[model samples]
Target: METVEFKGSHDPEKKIVVSLFWTVRKTIREEGCAPVHIKRIRTSRNVYEPEGRKLLKLSDDIMEDILRDMEMGNTVEFEMTMGTESLRVLIDDKRFSVEATRTPEIEKEIVEKLEHETSKLTPDFCQTFLPRIFPNQ
Candidate 1:
């Protein structure tokens, strides 16, 4: 069995984390794994103060957009606004902006099996296996 992992983080103020995991299974199966499974995790935290009511509203708006986009199978694009004191997330070309006294944190994780050739499986062999598993897309 073999495995690989990747991790990265962006600014804590608008904190973002991304991770990917790959694993090998079943030595008999060529490449150990015929296909890869992917999973993602995202987290956000916001703190509110008396004067930060507006910022809280913004956070809610952004979170809503993120959830909607995920349901629609879309990616999120992030931007800065209000002199970098605020953040914006775009979904399906629509943008939502928010301000917060304390920046919110965001994290994402993905785990999947990769069809990497071991001594038993070669790149040429994967060509035949991929089509059967991923017929379309």
Candidate 2:
């Protein structure tokens, strides 16, 4: 099997974006395929608080839940919040929500994987992937 491992530092500025990207990339690579493109949507600001942190922890716990659904060749949804801040990601019909937090170690692999997968896409493919992955904003 081809194992694509990613390593890097988790700079807060781009941690979440990087992590999500890598996760998608790793999934594609492990499947011996690549995505047409990967789009990243960043909230205007970071939301951090005690309650929000707890929720973020929960979100992390559900990472496997998110991955399993995605692995079924189905789209997965994610709703994330930090303090009063929140964002929702809808892939096909699957959906879930949680609070956001900074986790550099995990984010590093995610970002790298995303970059690797996206690098395989053609411009035309990216055109379609971007809109679908990030819709309405």
TM-score of each: 0.21, 0.27
Candidate 1, residues 17-134: lDDT per residue as tens digits?
Answer: 1111111122122233333321111323222222432222224444455455545645454432322233333222221122222233211101222222211222113334333222
Which 10 consecutive positions of candidate 2 have the poorest summed lDDT? 91-100
Query: Between which residue pairs do clashes occur in model 1?
Result: none
Could you tell me the lDDT of residue 56 within candidate 1? 21
What is the clash tally of candidate 2? 5
Q: Kindly list the per-residue Cα lDDT of model 2 for residues 38-84, writing each as its tens digit.
A: 22222223222224322232133243444444445344444443233
Candidate 2 whole-model C-alpha lDDT, 0 to 1 = 0.33
Which portions of model 2 miss their true places by more than 4 Å? 1-53, 58-61, 82-85, 91-117, 120-137
